[model samples]
Target: MTPPQVVVVMGVSGTGKTTVGRLLADELAVAYAEADSFHPPANIAKMSAGTPLDDADREPWLDAIAAWARERVEHAGAATSSPYGVRGVRGVVSCSALKRAYRDRLRGAGPGVFFLHLDGPPELITERLGGRQGHFMPRTLLDSQYADLQPLQADEAGVVLSVAEDPESIVRKAVTALERAAGADNGSGQATG
Candidate 1:
């Protein structure tokens, strides 16, 4: 049996991380998490109010999500009470993870943790954000997100997937990318993609 995978579907806000992440989780039959759900009320309030969070404000939030990832990997191959029942110990989470440092922090969670970066033009993302409703992040913060976004570096264990495709297509590509990464894991206890 293949070992579990912990993947972070990452990108700027409005880039469909949650949509694609959930779908990807379903495709992989893994448990899923939304990084937003781990935020403290203060962070939500801040974003809802159009305030972009600084690194200090984001530290704890990142730590919380990282902890969740760590816990999931630590318990790989074990049974857990979850809505997704009897999954293959794999885990997927949606997070902005706009910076390399942020991605590194998440990677520190555990081994075999990889990322699926959803990227697209700012105009496209802006349009999506404009049509969005009932979300804490405002369209105004889109610029900040774009500015903070650091593309996946060479050494990162991940792939940069475009958001130009439909959500289903993106999920299909992500699953394939993840599978390739897993298969390429070369026994170094890390994802090689």
Candidate 2:
């Protein structure tokens, strides 16, 4: 059987993951979720205080998002238990899945957990972060994020897109690439675009 699809829009902060993810979800008519919403109050407070969360701090947050992803998969045509509460077999989510281990953990959500990695130069991301407002994550944490990021390996089922492109262009390219991957897989469950 062909597995249900879940596209993970992943990158460090200020990489436009949320904007592009929402656009992609809307264009594809799939449910959308923000990884930040899965974070606990303590995690928010820690980041608000300019403190970078250690692995333990992010464990619960990642688990919550993974749970949501799995819920979307297992429910298939049934009503989703997520905030959208819609009946859909597909989903798009924005998450800073910097490390390989974290992405692997998220993959447990389903067989079709494909990732869309957004990346750009440090200076570009830093400027974007500086201009961004109302976010708990501090720009100072960007260095740590880059340090921890492990780009997708050749064997991983995913694609890397540049953040330097405009949002509309990026969304268009992402949709095209992911669709091509979906059609090319032939029920093999390999969706690397």
Candidate 3:
């Protein structure tokens, strides 16, 4: 039996991580978790007030998501062992894992964990941020987000997709990348054990 694939859709604010993540989850018939929903209210307040979140503000949230990912993988493993159980389930999470360390923490959860980096030009991201209604992240902080972004390394187990593309295209690209990665891993007979 094969293990489930977990994908972390990552980018700075207004890069459409949540929207694309949800759509990707739907297309893959998997579970979708929004990283923002796990954030503490204080962190949201800080960002809403045009204040950037320091490492201290992000530590707890990142830890929570990592734990959640681990738990999901464990649950899927258990279910797959049952005689009448469903096939393994995939997990798609939307997060602003701006730093390499954050992405590493997520990868530590399990093997076959992929990161999908959604990127776009600053001008486009700023426009999207401005157009968003009632979002906690202020447009004033878009610059801060751009400043904090760290591009994923070539060796990372992930794909980079352009947010400037249509949302449907972005979703298609992400899902296809994940499927191909899963196929490769399965063919190689690697286990997440």
Candidate 4:
């Protein structure tokens, strides 16, 4: 079996990060975390007011998530076997790691921090965002998110999937691609999946 790792389902809001992350966690049989859960109330309030979060405001929030990832990865190392008899822990988390720097901060938690970026055109994302309910993120903030989004660099260990496909198809591709990558690399990003 491949070694444990954290898969961060990332994208701008309304890209189905949380939905796909939950499904992926179930399929991977690992812990699932919502990025918003790591945000401070102040951050939520800011976004609720249609305000974009600058890096300074995100520092603590990112730090909190990073700390959680570290703990999860650390505990994973100590686990001889999981309930599924796996060797270590794996986690699927939904985070809007829009900027490369934010992703780098997450990687600081440990190795094997893979990113699964969900991307699509603004028109589609705008539609989805409009349909979403009970969410702090306003559709007005989407532009700022798109502006801040940095596509995955060549050095990063992750894949980017388009949101043009249906949710199930996207999730299926993600699972297949991630597993293949793990198997091909022995959990390293040395070869194509």
Candidates' TM-scores? Answer: 0.88, 0.88, 0.86, 0.88
What's the C-alpha lDDT at position 125 in model 2? 98
Per-candidate local distance difference test: 0.79, 0.80, 0.76, 0.81
Q: Over 4 Å off in model 1, which ranges?
A: 1-4, 78-89, 185-193
* Residue pairs that clash (backbone atoms under 3 angstroms), model 3: none
Cα lDDT of model 4 by residue, 1-193, tens digit: 2343788899999999999889777766778999999999999999999999999999888888888888788776444333334334478889999999999999888876888899889999999998999999999999999999998887787788888888778877777666555655443442222
When superposed on Cα atoms, how far off is each prediction in RMSD?
4.2, 4.5, 5.3, 3.4
Q: Candidate 4, which ten residues in sequence have the lowest lDDT sum?
A: 184-193
Worst 10 residues of 3 by lDDT: 78-87
Which residue pairs collide in model 2, if any? none
Choose the strongest candidate by lDDT.
4
Show the colliding residue pairs in model 1. none
Clashes of 1: 0
lDDT of 2 by residue, 63-174 (tens): 8999988877877684232223222338889999999889888988877787889989899999999999989999999998999999887656677889888998888777
Q: Give the candidate order by descending lDDT.
A: 4, 2, 1, 3
The residue-level lDDT of candidate 4 at 6 comes to 80
Model 1 / residue 126 / CA error / Å: 0.8
